[model samples]
Target: MPNLNNVSSPSLWQRIWQGFLTTVGTKQFFRIFAPWVKWLAILASIFLVIGSVWGLAFAPPDYLQGNSYRIIFIHVPAASLAISIYFALAVLGVIFLVWKIKTASLVAQALAPLGFLLCVISLITGSIWAKPTWGTYWVWDARLTSMLILAFLYAGVMALFAAFEHTANRGKAAAILSIVGAVNLPIIKYSVQWWNTLHQGSTFTLTAAPKMSADMWMPLLLMVVGSYLLVATLAIYRTNTLILYRDQGKAWVKEYIRGQNK
Candidate 1:
């Protein structure tokens, strides 16, 4: 007879942990999400096109900055996405370190290049906007300086991952660097408020309405949402490719590849 009295069931937390691992750690997870990538790209294209056309051509120009302000459609979205992607990297670092989720690490690594590109876009567009608005192409403003540091952090994380030969070690090193670099996020967010800088405060915030009129902000909003979707599509597509490459030798990967080739 079994000693039923001594039997213990898994705790709720344990069940949830296992569920998360199964859902995210499996290659099938990517397959389930694969269809969304195309839809996301389509939606992103629609929003960006509408937003860009409205912003660049139809929307009323700023009273002071005029058409130069239209660049915000690109600059704001890129900057926002750069910051958001770093925040995601930080979250992925935590997941990888705490749960040892390989998917989280892979996704984090996949996002680094995109994050770096977005950061560069933000900086370049900002400088272009600055030359007309601030009378200089470069400044040592806190916002700009902190954003530059973010770009370096992204580069460093990518380099750290590549520096290691062992997969586990590479993930660990990159995760740790990402976690450490997350401290810079707050500094970047509050830099304008914390110091008297040449840069202005955030254009959008949850607690307050936008300072700009609807025609100006509406298209900007569309661009922001489109940019987010575009980034998400790229991230998922890249992560899926990474997963397939990493599991190239596995039976499931081989089967998937064979099917795709057909």
Candidate 2:
């Protein structure tokens, strides 16, 4: 209460932006984030274990599909992560292209493999779910086809990064491909609604109440949240590894390695 009015307060967005800039400005950014990433990974692991166990053993089985429906706990989360991570890659791509942020490019490179893995998991799980529900494992449906295209896009980005020898050139090519591939995200999201596909509409939406009951959705929500954190932790870990090698000549990195060895 003592002259509090004299103190300046930053807005929420300003504080967030400043925090981001502070992280990006530091040479020891990985060291600063390593503990946080460790914690995030631990939290993700706990939630993932809880969610998977709950969904597999305790969630009520679908009246129509029985226990087979439990796979949604994995498939939905994988699919959601696949799309969400690509969107993240696109954002990183923009940052790299516009600002030439080396960290952003490194992070995008780190995320490519993880994104592709999640996409593969989504496709395989979807196909497994399909055989029991629709009597076929593969279909040329819009949603399915679009998701396949997404996988190819991920592969393409990874390939482009490797195809170039110059680091800047590699980043530019990968960033361009990532930005262009972002169009596929909307296509994947809307394919079920856009066409007469066998794929089911979303069980949840921003504007509508969840189509699923709480017992069915609670674990799904947990899985989705946990998967996001898991991917983020992995991406950060990968980026830190890459940065250590890329910035090996930097004094801080050498000091960090020396400390680790000690």
Candidate 3:
């Protein structure tokens, strides 16, 4: 008879190790992220091609801003993803902190740089948009101010992680910061409502129906989804790479890499 608790078989950690070994042998990291990444890439390409052709060649120019308003396709999606991806990172950060799962922590770290990049793009594009629409290059109103704060939060998290010497400690500290910042995200989202501001309310914001037509909005949606997939793929692949590097010299990890090579 099998002993109940006295003599157990392979533990959960052992199972995880074995799975890692098997997956590496098959080059499963790319295999796992590939399909989704490919889809995102394809959709993004299609959207850019179609949106550019339509916006440039077919669709009517903006009634208010005329040709300049065409920037919305790229600018809107970038701003949306900037906020969305950081929130997702914070969720993953929470999982990492609570479970002490190395993979989860690695993902949070890898994605931070990408999120920062998005935040930068959003701010730049928003500035360009604001120049014609708001008659200025920048504003200090609620939405704009809050988004600036969000970008700084991303920088702070990256700085915090880098400031630490030990990898494990860095992960824990970053996770804590992410969780705290995540709580502030909602406040940022609602700041326009909370206070009167110069920045125009969100065009694609969740609170109201989209003001643009299908022709204008469809490509924006495509870009948003495509950007999300691209980020997720980058995060997973980078995290896996980090795991392999960190695990180097360990017996199981060596075996896992060897299997991947084969």
Candidate 4:
């Protein structure tokens, strides 16, 4: 046989693609992120406590809604996170489908429950806020209806994943559902504007200054940041645990277990 030592190395794009896969495709990805989870949790707690106190106790009440509007501190962040998490799931779906990254599917699986919880929180809090503001606990308004649909989409994705016994099939089904469900996001986002709805337009926007004063918006900002950090902490920690459980039969996982026991 001819000597094969002179074979050409991988092209630059191939090398880059392989490097990307190596970074996110294995347990090493969890190893890199696991250490940050504790710190993220700590920071999340601190921000949430500070933000809650500031918004509830110190922030000036809305001139119109009075103290009742304070619920936005909780409601807005949860709603924002619910949508953001679903968007992330959609992106992960694309990643898994395109690259066949097992870790992306794992992370998506870890995030779905948290997203569903946030969606529920948003709906409950919005309903409570609505009773005072809209004189009803619920409505068929576009934004509200769209949000409710989002909650159902989250449920459907979870159910689809659980329905399948084969790992690859489960991931693929859930991912396809997630991707298809993303069509609802824009509808939810534009519902208030598209129809005459009880739901108000966005209070915060990148293109313009906040409609509210500094004292009002500051705590809301803090709360939003805290909520994101909290989600990150939970998602990363959950993903790491999942990685361990799924890879338990592998050599690296066995070594990790041995090290922990030691």
Top model number, TM-score: 1
Q: Output the worst ten-in-a-row residue range by lDDT, candidate 1.
A: 161-170
- Candidate 1 displacement at residue 144 in angstroms: 0.4
Off by over 4 Å in 1: 1-14, 165-167
- Please report how far candidate 4 places residue 210 from its true position, in Å: 0.5
lDDT of 3 by residue, 141-213 (tens): 7777778888888998888878873754867788888888887688667887788877666777567778887
Tens digits of per-residue lDDT for model 2, 1-262: 5899988899999999888877773365686777878799999999899899888999999989999998899999999989988998999999989977778888888999999999999999999999999999999999889899999999999998888746548688889999999999999999887888899999787798998889888888888889998988999899888888778898998898899999
Q: Candidate 2 clashing pairs?
A: none
lDDT of 4 by residue, 1-262 (tens): 8778988889999999888877895677888898999899999999999999999999998999999999999999999999999999999999999978889988999999999999999999999999999999999999989899999999988888788735558688889989999999999999988888999999898899999999999899999999999999999988889889888899999998999999
- Regions more than 4 Å wrong, model 4: 1-16, 165-167
C-alpha root-mean-square deviation, each candidate: 1.6, 4.6, 5.1, 2.6
lDDT of each: 0.91, 0.89, 0.73, 0.92
Please, what are the lDDT tens digits per residue for candidate 1 over residues 40-70? Answer: 9999999999999999999998999988998
> What 10-residue stretch in candidate 4 is worst by lDDT?
161-170
The TM-score of candidate 4 is 0.93
Tell me the spans in candidate 2 whose CA falls farther than 4 Å from its real position: 1-19, 25-28
lDDT of 3 at 142: 72
Root mean square deviation (Cα) for candidate 2: 4.6
**Higher-scoring candidate on TM-score, 2 or 4:** 4
